[model samples]
Target: MNRTQFLRLCALGAALAVGGPAALAQTYPSKPIRLVVPWPAGGGADAVGRAVAEALRVQLGQSVVVDNIAGAGGNIGTQQFIRQPADGYTLLLATSSTNSANPYLYKRTGFDPVKDFTPVASLAVIPSVMIVAAGAPYKSPADIVQAAKATPGKLSYGSGGVGNSAHLAGELFKSIAGIDVIHVPYKGSSPALTDVMGGQLDYMLDTGAYGQLKGGKVRAVAVASATRHPLLPGVPTFEELGIKGMQMNAWYGLAAPAGTPAAIVERLNGAVQAAFQAGDLGKRLTDVGAELRPGTAASFAAFWNAELQRYAGLVKLTGATLD
Candidate 1:
C-alpha cells in the first residue's frame, strides 16, 4: 500500500481495535454527574443520596448533583432514571424499597430491577425501628402488640407511602407479631412521622425517626434487627422481645443504567470504595442510623440480587401491593 493509505489503514485499525466510544474515552465524568434519588427530599434515602453525591464530588473531582425525582413509591423516578444515557454521567442512589421491594409490592415498577441497572457499590444499611409517640399508651413491643390484638384495626400505623421500606417494615411487624393494625400511607415519611409524633397515628416503623428519638418526641418500641444498634443502644431488638422472623433493614447503593461501560462501572465503584475509606461519609451515614456496607461491584450485585429475592418473599408474606 502507499504511504497515505498505510497511515489511514493504521488509524482505522487502531479505531477498530479500541472498540467503541466508551472504550476510547479517557476522561470519565467530564461534566457534573447526576445521582437520582427516587424518594422525596428530606426522607432517609434522600439524605443518603446527598451524602453519596458529596463524597463522589470529592473523590471523582466532579460535581455530583442530587436530583430528587420522587413519587409513586419510587417507580416514577426509577422510570425516568432508566431512560437516562448509560454514559456513567447519570447514576442512581438506589434503595431496597426502589430496587428490591417495590417490584414485589407494585403491579408495574416501570423498570426491571436486575436488567435495567448496573450495580456500582453497596454503601450502607439502615435498620428499621418500631416507633410510637412518646405520650402514647404503648411503651414497649409487647404493649403495642397487646393493644393491636385487643383493638384490632382500631390502632393504626403510618408510612411514607405504599411499597416503601416503612410500609414493608410495618407489614412484617404485623405478620410476625399477629396484629391487625391499620396502615395509613402518606406522601412522605416526614409527614407520617409528624402524625406519629402528634399521636394521630399509633406508630411507624422506619429507618428515619433518629432525630425525633433524640428529642424524646417519639419512642422506639423495638428495633427490627436481631441485635441492637449502636446508635440506638437503649432500644431493644424484636428478637430481644421474643419476636422472631422480623428483621427489616433498608439498604443503600449506587448504580448506573444497564449497558453502561464496565470500565466506567469499575471506576465508579472504586470511587465509592475510596469515598467510604476516606471522609466522614461513614460517620455521617451512621449518625442517621445507617451502618456502612461498602463492597466491590460484584459483591454489590450479588447482594442486590439476594435482596431482591428476600424482599420478594417478605412482600408476599405481607400481602402489600401497589400500582
Candidate 2:
C-alpha cells in the first residue's frame, strides 16, 4: 500500500526469481528421466537395465524410462548417450561389453568409457557359465581341453561377438588351458546360443544369458570364476575343472555423460544405492544370475580402470582384432 512496501516487494521478487530456480535445480530430477540400454530388448542387458530403471524410478520419485537402442555391439546406444546433455536426466546402462572390452576391441570407439562417462554405481556382476550342447562329446572343461589338444585348430567355440567379454573369456580359457580353440564369432549371444543348441556349434563360453540349463538344450560344464554360482551349483569352476587363471565375469553399472553436475551425479548414485538397499532388487538381480554390487563413484572408477587394464592384456595375448 506504501511506496517503501512496494520497493521491498520488488526486491524480494527479484531475489526469489534468481534463487528459486537454483534451489529447484539443486533438488534435481524434477521430471522423469531416460535410461538408455545399449542392447536389444529381451536381452540380459535390457532385462537388467529395466529392473534397475524401475527401482530407480521408485527410489528417486521420478519415472525412469528404459530405451533400447541396440546396434554395433552396443556402441550405437552408448554413442547416443555421449552426445546427450550431461545433466543426470539422461543415463546409460553400462556393461562390460561397452565399457571395459569394447574400447580395446575397436580401433577407435566413439566414446571413451573412462573419460566420457561418469559412473554412478555398479549394479551387479554376472559370472559367465561355460555351456556345451547336450550331445557334445565334451562333458567337462577338461574334455574340451583334450579335444582342443587333439585337434588344435579343429576344435572350435562360439561367442556373441569377436571382442565381446564372452569371446575374451573363451580366449582366456584357451590361454590358461594351453589349448587352441577356434572362435566362431556371431552377432550376439542369442544366435551363438541358438547354433550351439542346434548342434551347429560345439560349445559357447558366454555370459549367462542363454539360460541353457533350464531349457535342457545345453549342459553347463563349468563356470568362469573361482567359485561356482549358487544358480549353477552343480557346475564346476574353471579351477576345479582343471583350468587355472581363467576367471571372468560381466558387470553392469549406471553412468551419465561426463561433466554432469557433481550434485546430480551424487543424487543419482544415492538413488542407485537406495535401490540396492531395497531387498527385492537384489533378489531380482540374483534371479537374473547377477550378484548385487554397489559402490561409490571413486570405487567404480577404480574398478573400471582395473578392468580396462585386464582386458587390454587379454586383447594383446589373444591377438584378437575387431577392426
Candidate 3:
C-alpha cells in the first residue's frame, strides 16, 4: 500500500480500538449487580429495592442482589457504595434521606451527595400523610391548625428523625399554615407513630407504613401532596384546603458512584425504567403509597438538585439545625 493508504488505514484502526470498549461497556451487567439498600430491612426502601432488583434480574438476565447496609441515617451504606469502583457493578438505592436531606442534617457526611454520585434514574416517590391518633381531639385539619396557632409551641408533631422527610413536611406545614408546633424527633417512624397513638405525641407526619392506618391505629388528616391519595380517600390534600405550594413527596432513586462509564449508566437506567413498567412492580409501589417516577440520569440530577435547594430554604425557614 502507498504511504497515504497506510496512514488512512492506521487511523481507521485507532478509531475502532477506542470505540470497541465503549461499545462493550454498553452491554453492561454481564454478571451479577449489587444494589445497596441503605436502610434496615423490612421498611419501605428495603421492600421497594428488592422488588426492583427482582424485576431487573429478569431484564438483565443476571442475578441482581440487594445488600442492606443500614445505619447512620443511610449515610453509612451510601458512603460505602461511593467507595466502590464506579463501574456500574455497584449501585445505591437513593432516597430523600440519603440524597437530599441528611447531608444538611448531619454535621459531617462521608460523601458529597451531589458530587460523589451519578444519577441512574428515579425509582419511586413516597407521599407523606398527615395522621393523628384515633382518639385525638383534632378531628379536622382546620382544628389542628387553629390549635397550633392558639397554642404556638404547645402542639407538636413527631418525625422519624431530624431532617427526615417527615420532619421537613411538618416544618413546611408550620410555615405555610402560620402555626408554631414543636417538632419531636424519634429514632424511627415506627416509634414516632407509636407515641402518636399513645397520646404522647399530638400528631405525626408519616409515610404509608401499612398497618399504621389499616389497623385503625391513626386517623389520616391530610396528604402532603397536590392531590389526595387513593389509599386514604377521605383525606384532603393541603392544596385543596387553600394551602398552595405545600408539596412534599419523599422519593427514592438509583445512583452509581461518580466516574461510572456513561454506557453503563445508560444500561442501568434502562433496566430500572423497564422494571418499573414491568408486571406488578409499579402497582406494588403505588399500593404502598408511592408513585413510580421513571426518568433519565440528567433528569434525576436536575430533580435532586432542585430538591436540595428547596429543602435548604425550608430548613432555614424552620430555623432547624442539627449539630
- Whose TM-score is greatest here? 1
1-323 per-residue lDDT for model 3 (tens digits): 99998997787567647786565454566679999988766666777788788877887888989998877778888889999998788988888876788877787879987889988888888888888898998876789999888888899898766777788888878877888888887655667778898999888777745557888888887788877887888888878877776777778888889998777888878877787767566877776788778889899989999888876777777666652
Please report, in order, the local distance difference test score of every candidate based on alpha carbons.
0.87, 0.81, 0.80
Q: How well does candidate 3 match the true structure in TM-score terms?
A: 0.84
Q: Estimate, for each residue in 1-323, the C-alpha lDDT of model 1 and write its tens digit.
A: 99998997787568647765544344576689999998888888888998889988998899988998888888888899999999899999888888998888777889988999999899999999989898988878789888888888999899888888899999888888888988999877888999999999999998888878888999998898878999889889988878888899889999999999887888898888888788578877988889899889999999999999998888899988762
Q: State the lDDT of candidate 2 residue by residue for 1-323, as single tens digits.
A: 89998997787677657776454345578679999988767656777898898998888889999998877778888999999998788999998888888888886778876789898888998888888888888888888887879887887788777677778888878777888777887766778788888888778777755456777888888888778888888888888856777788888998999988776777878878887788767877888788888889879878888888888887888677773
Worst lDDT 10-window in candidate 1: 20-29
User: What are the runs in model 2 whose C-alpha is more than 4 Å off?
Assistant: 1-26
Question: Any runs in candidate 1 off by more than 4 Å, and if so which?
Answer: 1-26
